[model samples]
Target: MRILYVITPSRLSGAERMLLRMARVQQRHGDSVRVLSKPLDAFERAAADDGIEMVTGAIGGKLNLRACPTIVEHIQRFAPDVVLTMHSTGTLWGVRAARKAGVPCVALMQAANTRWPYTTAPAAVGCAEFVRQHLIAGGMSPDRVYAIPNGIEPEPYLDDEDRDRARSDLGLTPSDLAVGTLAHFTPRKAHSDLLDAAAIVTRSVPELVLLWAGEGPLETKLRQQAARLGLADRVRFLGYRTDAPRLHRAFDIFALPSLLEGLPLAVLEAMASARPCVVTAVSGNPELVDDGVTGYLVPRRNPQVMAQALIRLATNDEARRTMGLAGRKRIMEMFTLDGLMQRLREVLEREIRRQRGPGG
Candidate 1:
């Protein structure tokens, strides 16, 4: 099968990273996959490495009518079996272009909290059921939306030697109760909430240290916030890490106090690494982390409740180990990369077959 992916990414975050992984898998299965996106160096490099063609173009602003013709040209040239549009700009213009070129299009809605222009999209695949419901509520037909939660390859169970080495590399002492979070330092990610929670938790669990990874616009502001919250020494702002597995290995516990998410790949990576997660009960997080079973689920933007969860886990070695083991088991059994991709391929084929009705 030939697939064309349309997206305009400013950075290589969760959605872009997941999409690239999908592309790599498709290419491995001997399918022709091409991507139409803005010139993002990380994305381009990964695409080139995966043997996927990168079609660069500008898809800017809210209403991208100007980009539709460019997209149409790519559609006509590539002649893909289906076009999968991601992000708002891509879907808005890509759907139009796909229709113009007489090709099937499916919008990949990766978030549920933020509203995008998905109402007019013919067919769409949401990263989680929350996102699928978000689309249905936004006027898209329920029949047209499919939920295929994001997934990642489960990491092999780490030995004590591996965790120690990873921790030592990150300047973390084995004695420290390291709580790591991997996300862009943005308002939506709510890193401030984590910092505030860290302040409260450090009072109780002095050995606690917060490992905040990923880079974004709010870096400088977050650093200052850490200082003001009296958590400067307790928090490590490791900027822009591509080494997710190493980071996950180093973490005794993973936390994402974000206000929203659409099946965050960071949380999945942490779980796949056999680490327990503490995330806000919003969007797809609850679906992934089974509350008290795999990890704790606190209310959004509540530092006190988040801090309580962190403190509870930090003091209990048995709970952490049990939850971590359970989390990894869940990832392997339910959220493997291969399983999710098969679902995605099914959706693309289903749409293609529909477009070519009555056995064509």
Candidate 2:
């Protein structure tokens, strides 16, 4: 099978990271997979390391015509069995280009709360059923939409020695109740809310520290907010670190207080790392974290509720351990990379076979 993935980013984000993983898996399974994206960055370099052919194409301001011909040329040259478009804004141009080249296109709707104006396409794939239903309700045929969630490849957990090494490298002591979050500094991610919740947690648990990873436009503003709330010491804004999984191992607990999410990969990584989780109740988070079972789910954007939940996990070692074990079990059971890639390959192969039919 031949697959072409279309994404708008040159930098590494959750979606791009997923794309890189998927490309490597599909390539491993004897599928010829490549990517059509902007300039080569760290994300593209990672994809290239995975043997995914990268074609440079830039799309600016949603409907940039600069890359239209390049996209059309790639489609005509490669003649892929499936073209999977990631991100809603880029889907229209990608779908149209694929249609013009007489190829099948699948749009991946990755957002949780934002209702993007989707374009008509052969099929639409969403990371969560919530986004799938929203797309279908907005005039997309039910038969043309699928709910294929995000996934990751999990390895064995780092031993206590390695965990300690990571902590030492990050300047975290074993005594600190470290709660970390890996998310971009955006309003949708609600980093300020997490900071506020951390302040509340500090009042109760003075040994607690919060690590906020990833960078975005709101970094300076968030730093100011942290200082204003007197949380500058407890909250560490550890810019965008590529070694996120290692960071996950260093945390005693993971928190994601996002206002909205479409099954965050960071939460999945935290679960895979056997760390207890506390995430806001929104989008596919409830489906992932089994609230009181695998992890705690507080109300979205409510720092006080989040703080209370964090206290529960931080103070109670037994509860934290139990929930963390449960979360790891759930990730191994439901969100492994092999299972997700198999489903994706099934979708691509089925579409290709149907498109070819049984005739000449």
Candidate 3:
């Protein structure tokens, strides 16, 4: 199968990484895959490193309707079996391009950051079931939306030695509690709330160390919050990291206090690495975390509740181990990277056939 992915990404983050994984899997399966992206130095470099073919384009937000012709031209040139759009802007033009080029188009909704994409695409794949419902509630047909959760490769994280090395680098001792968060330091991701919870959690557990890995516009603000809360020494911002699975192995607990999410890849990677998560009970987070079984789910923006949950896991070694093991088991059983690709493959093939019609 030939799949053409379109996106207008400005950062090399979770969504971009997941798209790269999808392209890699297709290439490995003797399938042809090409990407159309707005030129981002970091994201372009990452795609190149993966040996994924990418063509830079001017495709972007609502105002960039001029990109539709270029996208259509590319579609004509590549002549893919299907065009899979990534998120909003990608969907906006991709769906239009596919329609013009007379091919099937499926948009992957990372989040309901933009609702217009749902109305435009013939079929949409949501990163989480929550996202599917969100689109359906906005009046998209039920049959046209699919809930395909993000997944990860568990083998790479199993028994990783990077854990000890990371601990050592952070000046952490065996007795210390290392809390890790891998997310873009953005407002919606609520890194500010995490800092507040960290301050509260630290009052009881002073041995707590935080490893925040990711850089964004909000990084400086989050750093200020950490210092303001007297957590300057405790929090270590690792900056943007591409080696996510390895970094996930370095933490005892993985926490993300996002205001909303569409099955965050960080949480999936953390679970695959056998780390208990303390994430905000928003969007698809509740679906992944079994609340005391796999991990604890705290209310959005509630630093007090988040801190309480973190304190519970930090104080009990057995609880942490049990939850971590359960999380990993959940990932292995339902969220393997192979499982995601298979599901996506089904969607892509089905969409292509649908576009071709019964006798084509």
Candidate 4:
């Protein structure tokens, strides 16, 4: 199968990473995969590093009528079996171009509560069930939307020596309890709530440090909040780490207090690294966390509740280890990279067959 993926991405976020993963898995499975996006950035560089062929085009603005011809030209040149689009802008233009070129198109919804730009595509994939319902509620047909959660390769995250080295490099002692998160420091991610909870957690566990990895628009503001709450010494901002998978080993508990999510890849990475999570109870979070079984789920913006949950995991080492094990078990059973690729392969093949007819 020949697959073409179109995306309009500015940074290396979860969705962009998923796109690369999809291309890699497809290529490994004997499928010809290619990616088309704007001028090279981290996404293109990473894809290139993986030996995937990437094509750059000007996919500007919301509708980008000018880009439609370019997209159609690429579709003609590559002659892919199916085109998969990620993000709103890419979906809008890719769907239009696919229709113009007479090729099958599929859109993957990466966030919750999104307004899908095109309704004519044969099918749309949501990263989680909540995301699918959100698309359906927003006027897309339920039959056209399917939920396919993100998955990860557990081998890279299974290194104990790398974990210990990361802990030592971060000045985190074996006796110290560390709560960590790897998310862009944006408002919707609720880094402020985590800072508030960090202050509260430090009042009880003085050795409790908040290790944050990632940079965004809200980095300076969050740093100020940490300072204002007298957590300047307790909160360590790692800032846009490339080695985040290894850094997961330094954390005693992984937490994400986002206002919303569509099956965050970071949480899954943490679970794959055998760490218990304390994430906000919104969107696809509940689906991943079993609330006291795999991890704790706290309400959004509730720092008090989040802090209490963090303290529970911090104080009891046995319970933390147990939950971490359960979380890894869940990922192995349901969310492995092989499972996600197989499902996506089936979806793309079915769509292509439907578009080409039985004998074509």
Clashes of each: 0, 0, 0, 0
Ten residues in sequence with the least summed lDDT for candidate 3? 111-120
Q: Candidate 1 clashing pairs?
A: none
Q: What is the C-alpha lDDT of each candidate?
A: 0.87, 0.82, 0.87, 0.87
- On lDDT, the stronger of 2 and 3 is 3
Clashing pairs in 2: none
Report the lDDT tens digits of candidate 4 across residue range 168-217: 89998877888999999888999999888988888889889899999999
lDDT of 1: 0.87
Better of 2 and 3 by TM-score: 3
Writing each residue's lDDT as its tens digit, candidate 3 over 1-360 gives: 888999988688878989998899889999999999988998889899999999998887778868899999899999898999886777888999899898898999887666786677889999889989999988899988899998887787777666788677767788778899988878899999988998999889998999988888998888888899999999988987767776777688999999988898888888878899999888889888889898899999899999999999999989888999999999999998899999999988887788789975
Q: Write the per-residue lDDT of candidate 1 for residues 1-360, one digit (tens) a residue.
A: 989999988888888888888988998898999999977898888778767789899875566567999898998899999999888888888888898888888999889855567667779899999999988888888888999999897754444457788899889887899999999988999998888899899898999998988889999999999899888888898988877888888999999998889999988888878788999999988889999989999999899999999999999999999999999889989999999999998988888888767764
Give all candidate RMSDs, comma-separated: 1.4, 1.8, 1.2, 1.3
| Residue 276 local lDDT, model 1 | 87
Model 2, residue 355: displacement in angstroms?
Answer: 4.7
